[model samples]
Target: MLLGVIGDDFTGSSDIANNLKKAGMSVGMYSGVPDNKIKLNKYNAVVIALKTRTIPIKKAISESIKALEWLKSKKCKKIIFKYCSTFDSTKKGNIGPVIDAIMKNLNVDFTIACPSFPDAGRILYQGHMFVNGVPLNESGMENHPLTPMTDHNLVRWLNYQTKGKVDLINSLTIKEGAKSIKKRITELKKSNVKYAITDTLDNQDFDLICSGTDNLKFLTGGSGIALGLPKVFKKKGMLKKSNSKLPNVKGNTIILSGSCSLTTNEQVELYKKSNPSLFISPEELIKNKNYHNEIIEWILRNSKKRPLIYSTTLPKKVSLYQKKFGSNISSKIENLFQKIIKNIYKYNFNKIVCAGGETSGAIVKALMIKELQIGEEISAGVPVMWEPEKNIKITLKSGNFGQKDFFSRALKKL
Candidate 1:
């Protein structure tokens, strides 16, 4: 049976996939599936791993609905499992964990707050098996029931979560943050069915919903942590504020901006033609309609064995929205983790490497994995191994570990 795992990220999905494979299972994982795109028929079962640092319940549930709709059309029996992005959200959201509660509300299969691996992106486990937060076999593994995620784990996790189901859809309980977000979202949903972050009611009251914006702006700011937004991102003024005393920059100090999701205008089209096919994937991924789904399908099609590149320039104001997203997103632990986790997962990748500290910390904290063990004994960075019944290992970093050539160097290895 083929198991599909989807996460708010790519690395976490990979870790679990690696574990499942080690446990002897056939798994296919992918992350960052654009709405209304991708075919689920390639795989039988499906899993959704919510990254607290990247995706929130508001976003995950919404995305899950879209994925479920597509899956149902493709005859996929989905068992969405809400796992941690490695941060402890109990005291933050007034809800429990983040993902599971949504599952409970959506009436999905499983939901629970699993521990996050602290290692940045290193495979930290061997011969271990965990299904539904329980050991499938004793003494054959060296890892815990729950896996942790780093900035490096997001890609792999997303891949594993969506490709298949590794265990029975079940969980013990939900965390407070999960409860809070679920409640607030539920209330909001009652008033508004669409979870999209646009509030047409008021000018200043944009929904600002989505997993990415939530973490970069709200949760990260609330923690008072100095996360550096990618330098490549060049957004405009006012839109880029900082949580610090003076400038309340949305994400860490650095941000990857100055890019657009699609091309329009002359300048955008110019860049689009220049970069024809950076990444290519299976054709089955593009079975959906619309540009959003088109992009996701394009990504899936381009992700076979090639690399998925996040453009630095072109489309003009892509960075502007990111800055807007970072500035306006709610400042709370739950919100920040939700956005960060989503960022990590939504971007599909197999082997993830990091070059930021705040990103690393956020990934570690979101998953709630304590033993990340950095410095000294940590030669190749820390890792939060979520070796479920799949075969994927996630590497993590503090976001600035690889200096400037981080993403490039990592790509070479891939």
Candidate 2:
């Protein structure tokens, strides 16, 4: 494979895979670290999606290292450690620790940490992250149940979890183009800076960042960093342009939402107004053993309306649940969704549209989906993925992605 990507979550994996495929490179997005026997020679890039975003630090590091070694075994020319554009992680991070482990494994001294996806309204400026013109701390992310981003400054946030020194690459030098950005990187290295949080204001900045860091062995960023990479490989004769077609999937559609992000809440509210919607609560999931069965029956009964089974709620409710039941409340919901998905598939409700990274990860794992063919984009960072072996198509969407009418729009696309 020309490039091997390690995504921190399922939706983010599909996000970057979508970008690479749109750039005309054949991409394979695996649910997790694939077995040794799966052949990957036909694709230019492979993305290993992991559920390490909210896991324990030590386990996350170990899993990330294992993925890196597997990619190396496949003889990948380069590696991209992809995460959310919002830079989702705690002060004791899976992001910083995982990056450290990968760097140690590769023996690479310098890499860029640029999680800027302007199309999604996420940008890094002066080393601070902003979402939709609002500071990250002020964004709904501050209320995130698992990894609440209370700090807008990424350098400080990352430094809390990594051992290396972190620095910034401001927009002024980036505006001077690739040559200037390269010089700045060289200077930063000399000063013993390990990670540079790059400034990106728009999509054009992605080209300069990709060109400037062309020589590096490792890169850490959101899917947007991949926007210019296929062209770089093409210029070097490492890639050929081709069109990607979606598979013709025939089945009833169902939307499962577990994200409580502000955007997701809006989407759920808007979608439920016209669709057959069922709200699954943490209380019911925890207290009732037969809750998943009820959810499955509801979806099968309302199959023609493109039913939505959601656990999405307001931030206050999420905080209350976390406080009352501890952090495992999220896991309970995920487990419930896993059961529902496994049961629903037997009935031909195959077009699964998932919101929330954790929920999507659970569905992929429950279905034992090892590999996915990246298909056409449904939104900026989300795409329709096909599992040809099972004749199933799914759209894994990050909680904060898609428009308010995303559920309805995504169902139409599927």
| Model 2 segments more than 4 A misplaced | none
For residues 293-399, write the lDDT of model 1, one tens digit per residue.
Answer: 44444545544433333222222232353354443321222233334334444453323333222233344444433221111111222222322222222344322
- Whole-model lDDT, model 1: 0.29
Scored by TM-score, the top model is 2
Give each model's whole-structure lDDT: 0.29, 0.90
Lowest lDDT 10-mer window, candidate 1?
220-229
Best by lDDT: 2
Q: What are the TM-scores, per candidate, against the unseen true structure?
A: 0.31, 0.98
Query: By summed lDDT, which 10 consecutive residues of candidate 2 come out lowest?
Result: 238-247
- Displacement of residue 106 (Cα, Å) in model 2 is 0.5
Q: How many steric clashes between backbone atoms does each model show? A: 139, 0
